[model samples]
Target: MLRKAEDVLTTTDVRRRQVDERIRRLESRLVREHDEVPPSLVHEWIERASARFGDARVRDFVPLLVERAVRASVLGFSSDQHEMSGTWLPDWARNTARRLLADELPRRWAHTAGVARRARQVARVLPVEERDLLVAAAWVHDIGYAAELADTGLHSLDGARYLLRAGLSRRVCGLVAHHSGASAVAELTGMAEGLAEFGDERGRLRDALWYADMTTSPDGHPTTVEERLAEIRRRRGPDDPVVRALAINGDERLAAVRRIHRLLRRTYKPARG
Candidate 1:
């Protein structure tokens, strides 16, 4: 998972030690059950799981949460040191996004579903191996808006940080970080330095994600890019940095949408089994 040990919340030394001991015990039990799995790998999973809940206000149940997360990582799907893979990604993304956004941000959930719908529709434009990446990124691109994960207040970067730490594919995190002309917004907001951690990923994958996000409305309906831009300007007002960034990059974003539409027109096909 993404590394930054210092980012975990500060805790009393006694509580930290107790949590460490409980995780150690959990690792031992896992080692006994899956003797084939390396102890170091098990330990790494525990650490990553623990890091994820570092900011939780209630610390007493953190060990249990870590155990559940580690078990899911180990037994629920085929994953690697820092990437989730296989046919499980889209389903996992949907479930996770629902868990994070359904109750707290219903409107955003609708938007996420709309983006996922658009992604599935356009996935055919991508290679077979890459289709899932687009759809999965679509589902969780707005996750940083979740109350539990909104550390930076910049949704794109905060969401990408959580995705990377949670062991999603780097490509998925990159798409979320740079989606819908986020780089321009980040620059205008003075968050470019923080957002740069994900590295810039361009080309078809990024464009496809932008197409999905830019064409979807806050309430999750399909719309023209111009209409979406108008809505954002209205909601944020003329002086908002996001509106300013859009003013600067609006034409480029429209060009990307048009290019995606042309690709879909030329080679539109439903996703295949």
Candidate 2:
């Protein structure tokens, strides 16, 4: 029995080291492929994978499964495709976000679509690059709310982390990371540090998304900021953490909404004879 116990311990130690080495190799490969992805993000992904497989009975395949799962979550394109530069959100991102949320959260799907529509409406007021980035952010802003992606229950951070892992542009990740007064809620959740890495997107783009998200109701209809805040309070209740946080930061959020509206009025001009 003593000899058998020693053998078991030896096997376990070797497997643990192997898993560590594999994760290191995976991190190196991800860095090579995604130069913009922060090392901290890569480490977080590996840690999450390790925790997920810690108790599995199949020790031999844990490393392989971890690699596959991490790659699937973070990589959305082939090597050649990643090398190309473009402004538009890829079809795969839209499809992936839709697949993750459409069946499980139909209301969210509708709201995302509505936000995308708002992004489109603002296209004429923004530069080409900004327009595309805003549209991309709108399409995937709420993806963190998807069941499969809600690791921290802070959709902005979760969605941004997933996108960063998938090798999306850092700007899009940043926008998703800090959208819709997420920083206020992040403070309440102890996730503000993780979200700080992405930084904030440009002011115009950030405010554009803020307007898109705040103006649209959960049911996907247009509404004023007052109505939207009321709706959120109604849905989440007075005692909810998000409600409390929003109340504390309501002035800042309302200011952003008003700023975007003013920007829209200044920039948008109707075509006339």
The residue-by-residue lDDT of candidate 2 on 166-248, one tens digit each, is 89889889999999888888888788898898888647778878877886778665555777889999999988878988866
Candidate 1 scores a C-alpha RMSD against the true structure in Å of: 21.1
- The estimated TM-scores of all candidates read 0.66, 0.65
Each candidate: RMSD to true structure?
21.1, 20.6
> Highest TM-score among the candidates is held by which one?
1
**In terms of lDDT, which candidate is strongest?**
1
Off by over 4 Å in 2: 1-90, 269-273
Q: What are the lDDT scores of the predictions, listed in order?
A: 0.77, 0.73
RMSD of 2: 20.6
The alpha-carbon deviation from the true structure for residue 140 of candidate 2, after best TM-score superposition, in angstroms, is 0.5
136-204 in candidate 1: lDDT tens per residue?
999999999999999877899999999999998777888899888888989888899999888668788
